[model samples]
Target: MSREKTKGMSIIVKTITRLTVGLVLLYGIYIVLHGHVSPGGGFAGGVIITLSFVHLVLAYGKDTALKKLSKARASFLENMGAILFLSIALLGFMGGYFFSNFIPKGEPFHLFSAGIIPISNIAISLKVGAGLFSIFVALVLLKLKPTSEKKK
Candidate 1:
């Protein structure tokens, strides 16, 4: 493969993808942290974050996204995040029934408030983001064919 013309174009695309993905990640973090006090939650933030990666895959290509993140790793993260959230909820059961606020709820309108809600949001964000991102990647990869392979 010649590294001439493709270099310049790839550099530009890489820069744009990095910036967009970074912003999306930051926004997702913000939404998750403020879930207890704001309208958005883990699920919403997660979707937004995943969309960022989807954009990267679309704008740049599946190969670039896959280079940054492996399919297996992404799937593992998604499962782990779900497990973490479920474990937290199970812990609450020990207190009484379920989701019993095992942690101390600070004050309303504060970061420390909402006991386990904030944590759960973070977990869900991780699970949903990675899961959705992986799904998108799989679909894109499925459609991509080696350039060397000529059509019949």
Candidate 2:
């Protein structure tokens, strides 16, 4: 008989995960968006975002977490994040120095204010979040390899 793929943890754990994961993701996005105005920035927010996925992995399993976010997709996102951050930095050349604030800063406290801060925060968040996830996946995959197979 063919063994079916494992889905996740028990019902209670899954139910809680389903309820809380969205909130965690939302908070991460909020932190990223408000990085300029508030304390939390891309790195912190990205870590939180990564934690949400890691929570899934811990609660459910690698298979379930990976099913939601495949390795290939995570790699692609990580690359995209780096490229985007680099592009933003490069764009600063048009303004003046590296990562210069090119756009006009609106009235303080508004969403569009702080010029490139929010955008940069977003780019950094993407990079950090995806990078962390990729690393986790790599470690997990490496651990899964059979010890005896290494000798063969």
RMSD of every prediction: 4.2, 2.9
What stretches of model 1 exceed 4 Å from their correct place?
A: 1-15, 144-152
Clashing pairs in 2: none
- For every model in order, what is the number of clashing pairs? 0, 0
List, residue by residue over 1-152, the lDDT tens digit for candidate 1. 66533532467677887777888878888898899898999999999988877776776666666777789989999999989988998898877868788888888898889788999999999999999888887776676568765754
Number of clashing pairs, model 1?
0
Q: Quote the RMSD, in angstroms, for model 2.
A: 2.9
Tens digits of lDDT, candidate 2, 1-152? 22343455676988899899999999999999999888999999999999999998988888888999999998898899899989999999999989898989899988779998898899899899999999998887785556897789
Off by over 4 Å in 2: 1-7, 144-152
Q: Report how far residue 98 has shifted in candidate 2, in Å.
A: 2.0
